[model samples]
Target: MSSPVALIATAKLRREDIDAFTTWQGRHEAAAATFSGFLSSDLIPPGKDGHDEWTLILNFQTADQLTIWQHSAARASLIAEALPFFIGGNTGQAMAGDTAHDTSVTGVTGMIFSRIKPGMEGRYREWAVRIQAAQTKYPGYRGIYLQPPATSGKDATWTTFVRYDTRAHLEAWMTAPERATLLEEAEEFVDNMELVRLATAFPGWVPVNATTGQGPPDWKTALLVLLGLFPIVMLELRFLNPTFSAWNMNASLATFIANALSVAVTSFVTMRLFVRWFDWWLFPNAHRPADTTLKGLILLFMLFIGEIGALWWLLP
Candidate 1:
């Protein structure tokens, strides 16, 4: 896959036309979702100070995917349809820049849009680097994508992409004591903030229909996770623990190491593969749902049988 790209557009509106513009924006977003490579999209409403106007942010899996969407006739049709509503003169150009997306970035992302004080761009960027470095030291930290204020927008704005393995870790860093100090240090620069979480954790990797909604039901997710994690846990327990035990580590530390190793295996290997196998279950829309419930029930029963068999084999 190509490197992911952060594409943002800002539009200024006649205050009275906000409602009409928003309706058009929704249709536009729906159209964009049909295309391949689209990841997630968000809209930031204009602020009280009239700094940002309105912003539409989009994430694509690759630059090529973005280009395909950008040059598509469908996109052109929508823009043409909505041109009349841009009475306040669109400021979208200012909200986008040549922001680079890192291909290696996988997992959930936190898309943060921040507007800095007019003269604070340099200081804001410096502060951003420091905070990202600090966050890197924390667990689940993946990487970041920063887009500078566009030359055509109404204000000095920046978009930061924060990738994390889980929401818990993301929240931890956001609420950490260090973050308080970091925010204080940047108080002179940041003017406003808008943050949108990118994806539901990993079970979301189930490539279902293109949607922004939460992944399948909690029970479904729990079942799928259990399916993916169980064998990984069993295999590691059977083979890997003895290797760690040779180091004569304490029971608590040894268990921790085993857990960490197994979780890593689950996240990167098993879960990735299992999602494909369960794609029909995850994305019922892609296939007929006539017997989905039956399939799921049968699979659960099979898992029940397998568990008893595996236990019999390993117990001795």
Candidate 2:
């Protein structure tokens, strides 16, 4: 299923207000948790650029809950409390999906922005279903997402998203003769078509350069993920095993839940910590080749040493 509806907002913080802002943020999140349909939230701190901005991503189970929370007195009071910490007014965008919009670019994703011909909605949808099925045969195909026109809108514009593990894989799908034929098939149904790569700032453990609004290369992302996840998983396994054993729950289900929580912690807390610690390697001439590659190799070597040390110290 898709992710819950969410309001994603970012505040430019006063340099001196960082601590106070965090305190208020924590309180605000706690309040939000009390609301119905509240699922999860994450606090994204500024990057190496010293941007002084913090992002709050809040998720609720439904549009109704999202609206209620937006207009709730609790939320209003929290906003009023946070005003002094803001260097600038907050900016927000509402989105719904399996993951937050910013995080969706962890892989190479393509957006197909199209408008249907008037009175052709029925046929266009049929065509879309067929194309979606065709795409499943492609290698590395992750999934497709569809966003219809807003409520009560006449224009039949549709935003369709497709994702694959790598740009090369995505390109293969796009440039394939099969895809070309499919586009020809869809030409009359779609009045306008635009394809572009989605750029992202931060997704998860991967460092997406803030300045460029682009994610790090795949190798860098993989290595950094390993750097963070290796220790996190190991430590969780070592310390959490006893607690899991004590639980009356089925062992398989217990293990699954424990691992899931471990990953959630790694995504929301652990990665942010490493991003700050590895800022130098992540953002240095991020656009240039060899620069990041060389530095990533160095960090990877360090990670190897850290991994060995962790196993020695944490393992029985």
Candidate 3:
């Protein structure tokens, strides 16, 4: 199923009211924890500009599911609790899945952001570091990274990376009582922040895997293959061209070089196009299935074979 992307933004009401802000935020977090379809919320800290802004990025199964939370009584209560802490206000946007939205084919990636009180920034980081380390022992946990907010700002922010297997899986994690309580605890450190979620836009197909463990494509291998093709191509083009000039170079080493280059280029292009397409249609954590990868590679390789065969038949 395709997941809808949510972009949520929030900021503080006052730079000096950290204690009151944290208290109100804790209750607000509690309120959000009660909602359904609440996959994961990211609390992004204010960046270099000292904006005290926080972003919550969420993934949901569909717009309908998101609407449930949008219209929920709990959400109303949460907002009311957060009203006094609201500094700069908040805004949200939800994009419906088009042909390009697919998380099942391309992995989706997410980052969590939060703004800790100025003097409490180190404590907030300590909690995140320890909690993330403990969470890594769980089944769906992949890996994580951290980023600190600007020190020059009135509000300090921190960011962390989190991964899950699917939108459903992420929702399940959020729905847990333990997880909700952790959110409440985390809220105690922040004056105000937002949780913003984003997914790449692709058409029609969803990603199959969303785990960070799958790793990115081996660009080194692809680059080596391209580098290796150069010498072969030059040898055939320059040294063997004279000897096979009568046969249009089809019988010469250049033909092999050309075939190899074609294969390598085609594979590289196909992989990139596929990744780009998947990024658009699916979440960053999503992945195309193993069979899907095989099928794509086969199709690419066949195109290469056909090109070579056609050249042999027509030119020679």
Q: Which candidate tops TM-score?
A: 1
Task: Write the residue-wise lDDT of candidate 2 on 1-316 in tens digits.
Answer: 4447878888997667765775666567667766787765655555445555666777777878888999999989989888888877464567874343455334677766677777776676666655665665576655555555542245556766676767888777777777767777776767656564543333545544322334556665556667777777787778787677777668888789878977887788767776667666665652356666577687679878978775986776
* lDDT score, candidate 2, position 254: 78
Candidate 2 collision pairs: 3-97
Tens-digit lDDT string for candidate 1 (159-213): 7777677777877776677876786676577776545543455443433222222
Clashes of each: 3, 1, 56
The better candidate by lDDT, 1 or 3, is: 1
After superposition, candidate 1 runs with Cα above 4 Å error? 1-45, 52-212, 307-311
Greater lDDT among 2 and 3 belongs to 2
TM value for model 2: 0.35
* Model 2, position 265: C-alpha lDDT score: 79
Candidate 3 lDDT, 75-165, residue by residue in tens:
6776676676666757456655421212332223454556667677656645654455345334443333344442437655565555554
Please report how far candidate 2 places residue 63 from its true position, in Å: 30
Q: What is the C-alpha local distance difference test score of candidate 2?
A: 0.66
Lowest-lDDT window of 10 residues in candidate 1?
204-213
